[model samples]
Structure formats: structure tokens, C-alpha cells
Target: MTPREYCKIFAAEARAIPDFGAVPEIIPLYLIYRPANTVPYATIEEDLVGPFERYCVKERDGSLAVQSSSEIAQKCCAFQHWLYQWTNGNILVTDMEGVGWRITNVRIATKLKGYQGLKESCFPALLDQFAAAHRCNRYCEILGLKSLESLQQPAKPKGSKSPSLGRKAPSAQSSPQLQKKGLASPQGTRKGAVSPKASRKSTEAGEAQLAPKHKEEGSC
Candidate 1:
């Protein structure tokens, strides 16, 4: 089934449980790929692969229980089938009992020869299918799951200056100097001669004074 369908089934099944009020916890499925020629680390392989195999076995027997009260066994089985198909049966389950849940741990070791075609086709298709199936927009809200927007650095403001910490003060010699040169001093000028009105008034006053003198001379 498609990833959305899987999620819907998962959600519905989770809702059917007695106390399934919150979203079901999703555990990370780890798969490691390595070259076949190298000697396998037995302890690491055993630690990782054992639990996953046990979980598959228990899940196959209907003994696995999830928090969801609904029929999630079919969904889990389908998921396992898809995983096996993707891995081309090279995937091995290593652990299951430690967490007391049916979460499978997986490991993959590549065979050097006769698997070139399988690796080229199956690996890419598997990744594409897995990406298509489980991808959800809801992961945008998860903490530490960054988005494209988050990857961008914030913009800096224009003309920003560094703080004046532990720097020397400006020197007084740097102050602007007024240039004094051979400039001529302004000479004060005398006021202009009397206005036309004043001149006319003075002439009229002199004529009035001569008229009185003429009238007195005629009387004499």
C-alpha cells in the first residue's frame, strides 16, 4: 500500500486502542550497508541483527503487540515484506527483545560479485519506494528536523558598524582646521549725501526765509 494509506491505517488502528490518545511513537529503522569481503564484526552483527530477527519471528506468530488496539499486525507484516523486497533478502534482523517491543533491527552486507545489477536497480528503487511511502509533511513540525527555510542564514542589515570595544579614541589633531589666508579687511564707507526730499525741504526753508526778508525790504 502507499505511504499515505499506510499512515492512515496506522492512525486508525492507533485510535482503536483503549488508551491511544496521542500519536503513536515512530522508531527509527536502522539499516547498514557494507562490503562483503571484509571480516564481519561478530559482536556488532549479533548485537544489531539478533533483536530484529526475534521481533519478526514474534510478529509472524501474532505475539507482537503495539499500543494500537486495532489490527496493526497486518500493517507491520506488510512493512516487513516491503523492507525485505527492497533489501533483496540481503537484510538481516539482529535484535528485538531488548526494547520488549516488536521493533526490528536490521543490517545489510553487500556481496562483491553477481549482485551488481541488483545493487544498481534494487537499491535505488528501494530508496525511492521507501521515500515515497513513509514521507509525510507532518515531519516539518518535529524538533531538529530542519526545513529549507531554516537552512538559510538570516539577512544582515545595511551600514552596521562594529562595537567600539577596546579601541583608541579619535585624536584631537584629526579635528578640522580653519585655513587663515591673505584676505583683505572690509573698509567702511561714509553715508551718501542727503535724500531728494531733505534737499527739497532745505531749499524751501531757505526760500521762505528770503521771502520774509524781501517783504521787510519792500516795507522799508
Candidate 2:
């Protein structure tokens, strides 16, 4: 059965204290409404306390009858089944459920070593954890449980400097050094924009000056 159908069946048919007594036909275990943009823990204490207190195993002998640890253990079993069915073993329960399970596992270990009545100490917290897990699931559904790594801005590489945003920083290599033009620096000449004619004339003049002087016969 689908989880929702299972939940509906549980709400209607499941006995809270394992005995026939007046109980909520529908336990609103799942939160449906809350303040805008806010996620809060589920209100499950009332749901647990009512049925647990009302339908606890009654002693036939005339004495003070209290809730049994066995009943709590039964409730825990139901909780585990629901959790497993709901999650379908795909996503691991973390946060409250995870923490409570850790404690319960330790307690079980201690119980195996001769400890008893651990469920009396463990059940209430487990109920709270179950409620928290429900709340978390609801929150994830509403807000979406996606990896933020794709949405997040990528981190800069290590040791890389950030580009300044306030003002443009001057670059050392941007402005090239001016190339010299002829013997004189022309007032209008740009660094790399030297006139080709002036360059050719300058080369010819330099060659003439460097040539050997020839002595010739006296002219008439």
C-alpha cells in the first residue's frame, strides 16, 4: 500500500495502547499548517499522552496501575514499521530520529547485559524523535531537499586574488613603453605610431654618416 493510504489506515484502525478504548480516529501526525515561511516541530505529545494514559494495561488487583514499558515498546515497533514503510529505505532518517535510535541501540545493548525497563526511559524521547522526523520530512517536501552545491556560488581557487570591484586597478603591463622615433621626439607622435617616412629618412642619414669619406681629383 502507498504510504498515505497506510497512514490513513493506521490513523483509523491502529490501537494506541493495544487495547480497545476511545482514541483519535485520525491522529494529525503530519503537520498541515504553520506560520508563513516557518517550519516547526510536530505536536505529537498530546497524541501519545492521551491514548497511552487512557488505555494503559489495568491491573485486575486493586492497586495503582501505571503505563507498562511493554506498551511503549509496542508503540516503538509501530513507529519503526511506519518509518521504514514511509522512507522505503531510500533516505536514512537523520536529526532527531537518528539520535534517538543511537540511544535506543545503546540501551538495547545494556539490556542484553541484564538491564531492564529501558523502554520506560526511552519511549517518550523516541516519540519526540518520531515527531521531529515527521516535521523534517514535511519541511524538506515544502522547501525542497536538493543539494545547495549547484545553487551556491562556486568557491575561488586557493591563493587566487579576488578582482577589485570598487575601482579599476592599474595594470603594470597594460601601458607599453614608447618606442623612440628618429633623433627627435615628435610632439604629436604616439609611442608605437611612428611615421614610416621619418623612420626611412633616419636610417638613410645614419648610413651616410657611417660611410668612409673618399678623396677625389680636384674639380675644374
Candidate 3:
């Protein structure tokens, strides 16, 4: 969904919750699942279990709470129940492994944050849980937010070049080269410079040249 639509969903859901006051500053969390990779059992225990224990301790004092989707599911009984309701039991307890449960929780948490005064209720521990589960640190960079020291910027997708950095997206009339490449005469150029019919004929001639060579090889 578009960012604005995402924001709206968060607002509506947050308002529906009892005792969820004004919204907090909402940040969108994008979760990408990578289940094919082997999970390092030691790393998972250290990273997930360790901090989770600490988070529960902090929650008792009202100083920290879980905010992200997965953490929220783990921490809040109400939210866990809500998940079952929302998914119509498609996500059973056994199905939580490698599932993006935390991503959904983070979305709900952020929406609640947008309500009048719920940011404090949503704790940093929760945000951390969301970040860990869904790798939010990388997404934060895409949205131009702070990057975690452990997180590297996501690679530019293969064969997909970004438009020049700092350049605005080009409009139809913006690039003369693009106009020429599209076989449209550049605006105000000489008539002979670009002829649509001639361009078509030239393309046909080039294809013909390649075709005869292919035919000759087949015959040989």
C-alpha cells in the first residue's frame, strides 16, 4: 500500500483499541522474510531470547514495552488473540516459525502510536523486537532514517539502475535523448532529423540484414 494509506490504517486500528490514547510518531516497517538461510542457533538464542527477557523485566516497571509486530504478539495476550481473530485462524501456534507475525504487529503498533498519546505505551523494546524480526534497520535507510551500525544499506536491485542521485524523476519532455530513442522528433528540430516512417524502415532493414545471415547458416 502507499505510505499514506498505510498511515491511515494505523490510525484507524489504533483508535479502536481501548486505553490507546493519542498516536505516537508512526514509522512504517517493511519486513522481508528469508527462511531459506540457515538459522544460527547460538545467534538466535543470544539475540532473540536475551533481549526478550530484558524487555519483560522493563515492562513490569512501565519504562519499556514491546512495539513491533512479533514482539507484540509474544508480549500482549490481547494482541495475540487479535491476531487469531484477524487471520481467521490461518496462523496457528505452530505456524509462527519464519512467519512475518512481527511485521504485522509492528504495523499495528505504529498505527497505535499515531493515536493521541500512545507512544509512551509502545516501548523501545517492542520497536527493537520489530527491527530484529523484520530487519527494520535496512528499511529505515530507504525511508532516510537512521541506520543501525550492524545494518548495511540494502543493495540496489540487480540490473535496475536508479535514476541519477539528486536528480528529479524525468518527465516526458525532460530528456532529448529519450525523445530520440523513442523515435519521436525532438521538439523544434529540423524535419529531416527524425522521420517516424524512415525510423521504422531503418529498423526493418537492420532486422533483414540479421535474418539473411541466419538463413544462410541454416542452409549451409
Candidate 4:
């Protein structure tokens, strides 16, 4: 599907996704078009401005090489994985780009109805290689996207996260000795909570890593 249709469906499906409060919102907007001489219309999108910056979440071949990738970019990668499993591996949108999480110019590699979407980028080999190409990120686990094991075994959504085998999740308790040292003060955040300073530091590192363009991997 074109970005026009794709963005619409993406917004609808994304609503069910857990936002984690702090992650940048994925607000894919409409694709505006203008009349063209040869074609009926020319595809165009709004230009991003100011301190706002564009980011590459994943390459066309599904490489996540940006080691310090922003949380938003990492989240976007998980979105691609979720989309793949949501469609039963029929589609894996890649080459994602946008300012913040307001994405555009994404390429969809689809194997639905025997139709290979995006003739320029979607190829048979790429489809088979995706199982090896993608490496699940922390966000992927948070969203419960099943790891891609093989081409024949298409991943299906594991749905909302729930304990495996009915086992309880680890408690967030801390030892009294640790609390005395202020490592786990009652007034302080629970485990996994990030401080404002640390969050900003991570964001800066991720933006620096994203400054360079991602190299093309494989044929896709």
C-alpha cells in the first residue's frame, strides 16, 4: 500500500500498542500530493523544521546497527517487528524515517496474496532473509513480538504481555541493607525507572549515533 493508505492503517493499529508514557508518539500523518505532468499526482509530505531531527530506525534489510539508537527509534524498530507478526510475516515495513516519531517515506516489504510490494526494494531473497536479518530489541520484548525463527514459521502476535507458564513476575522489592545505603529508598522510583538526567543523556547519545546514514545491507 502507498504511504497514504499505510499511514492510516498504522495509526489505527498503533492505538492498541503500549506507549510507555515517555516514548515519542508515532503520529504518521497524511501524504499530500500535487498534480504532475506524467503522473496523475506527485507524492509530497510536509517538511520538518527547527531543532526537530529526522531519524532512521531500521535499514531496508532490517539491520539495527545504530548502537545508541534513541528510545523512539528503538520503539519504531519494535513497531516494525510487531507489524510483521501482526500480519503473520506477510509484511515487514522497513527503511523507516521521520522527525521524532512522526514517520514518513517508509518502505513496506510485503508477501501478501503472492504480491511482492515495492518492486524496487521487496525481493524474494529479502523475504527469506528477514528471519536472520532482524534482531529483537528490548522494546520488541515489551510489546510481546515473537522472535522470527524461520521463513516457513511465520511469527504470530503473542498478544498483550502476560507471564509465561503462569509464573509470577519478579518482585520489585529491595533488601533493607540496600535501602539503608539509599540505593532503593522508598521515596525513590522503583526498579526500571530512569532519572531525567539519564534519560536526556541516552537521548543525546542516540541522536549522535543516528547522525550518520545507515549503509545498505544485502540486496534489499
- Who wins the TM-score comparison? 4
lDDT of 2 by residue, 17-126 (tens): 34522222212234445566467444442223222232112134522122324433333334333443343322111111111111111111111211233333322333
- lDDT tens per residue, model 1, 1-220: 2232333455565556545344322244434655574853323222333423232232433232233323233334334333333445333121123232333233222323345344332232333332333321332222123333322345576895678856777655554441222333233222354578899999999999899888888998
lDDT of 4 by residue, 128-201 (tens): 55666678888777666677885356459786855685886554464555556855565555556778899999
- TM-score for candidate 3, please give it: 0.19
Query: Which 10 consecutive positions of candidate 3 have the poorest summed lDDT?
Result: 90-99
Q: Candidate 3: deviation at residue 61, Å?
A: 30
TM-score for all predictions?
0.20, 0.19, 0.19, 0.49
Compute the lDDT of residue 114 as modeled in candidate 2.
18
**Residue 9's lDDT in candidate 3:** 52
Worst 10 residues of 2 by lDDT: 102-111
Off by over 4 Å in 3: 1-12, 21-51, 54-75, 92-220
Runs of candidate 4 exceeding 4 Å displacement: 1-19, 22-40, 51-68, 112-121, 150-220
Q: Estimate candidate 3's alpha-carbon lDDT, on a 0 to 1 scale.
A: 0.38
Off by over 4 Å in 1: 1-41, 44-136, 148-160, 164-168, 173-220
Top model by lDDT, which number? 4
**Lowest summed lDDT window (length 10), candidate 1:** 135-144
User: Which structure is stronger by lDDT: 2 or 4?
Assistant: 4
Ranking of all predicted structures according to lDDT, beginning with the best and ending with the worst = 4, 3, 1, 2
- Candidate 4 lowest-lDDT run of ten: 20-29
